[model samples]
Target: MRSERPFSVFVDEFDAFASPAFATFLNKGRSSDFMIHLAHQTLSDLNRVSPDFMGQIMGNMNVRYIFRQDSQPDLGKPAKTR
Candidate 1:
């Protein structure tokens, strides 16, 4: 159910916030790991019971997908002299 167009647009729009949010969610709070673990467990349980449960959960959560793009120019193009 992945869409390249939406992922690309999301990454382009939210790349800046992604890293910060990930870092904060991973390291800033003592319960972050627990929250992630709980989410995984719930998803696993729901998946086992109903294949479409995860999609429903994500849709309810308003979750979005993103993809990283290499936007840098080729080095062979030559660097501007400072």
Candidate 2:
């Protein structure tokens, strides 16, 4: 069943938030009516601030879109993050 009132969260420039609790919303916000969207420049931005969070961050996101200036990486393979 889907809710008529859908909820969404969009976080732009995601690397600015350094707190662990802020990231936890990605995990906890998954109600049937909720959607989460995150945007950032690069994966390195995340790795620099919190190396441990990559696993947690990737776990919650079922859909991923990667865009680069020169060329897009081959995203044919499935993500294998724990």
Candidate 3:
């Protein structure tokens, strides 16, 4: 089933699939109705899928989210941080 609103798809360990279908979907169907979210542990994971594919995949992503693994996440926060 599908919807008019964009649905977010989170793919964990992106290299495991190694399916070109994903590349085609993200490339040709880059619209609001469907969106793909990809995550990988390391650069090697993506490399395993093919460098060219990786580049094209990365380019398809409009937003980038990053996280930090510090000892204490709130340690350096200033007054009344959420």
TM-scores across all candidates? 0.24, 0.71, 0.64
lDDT of 3 by residue, 1-82 (tens): 4576777778887778756677887776665477778776544455566756656666677775546424353334222222
- Highest-scoring model, TM-score: 2
Local distance difference test, per candidate?
0.31, 0.68, 0.62
Task: Give a tens-digit lDDT track for model 2, residues 1-82.
Answer: 5778988878899888745786677776776678988887766566665777755677778888876533234233224563
Best by lDDT: 2
Q: Write the per-residue lDDT of candidate 1 for residues 1-82, one digit (tens) a residue.
A: 3333321111222222333234344343233223222123122333443555433434333232223323353221112211
**Which pairs of residues have clashing backbones in candidate 2?**
none
Backbone clashes in model 3, listed as residue pairs? none
Could you tell which candidate, 1 or 3, scores higher by lDDT?
A: 3
TM-score (C-alpha, index-matched) for candidate 2: 0.71
Which run of 10 residues does model 2 get worst, by summed lDDT?
69-78
Which residues of candidate 3, in runs, are more than 4 Å off?
68-82
21 Cα displacement, candidate 2 (Å): 0.8
Q: Which ten residues in a row have the lowest lDDT in candidate 3?
A: 73-82
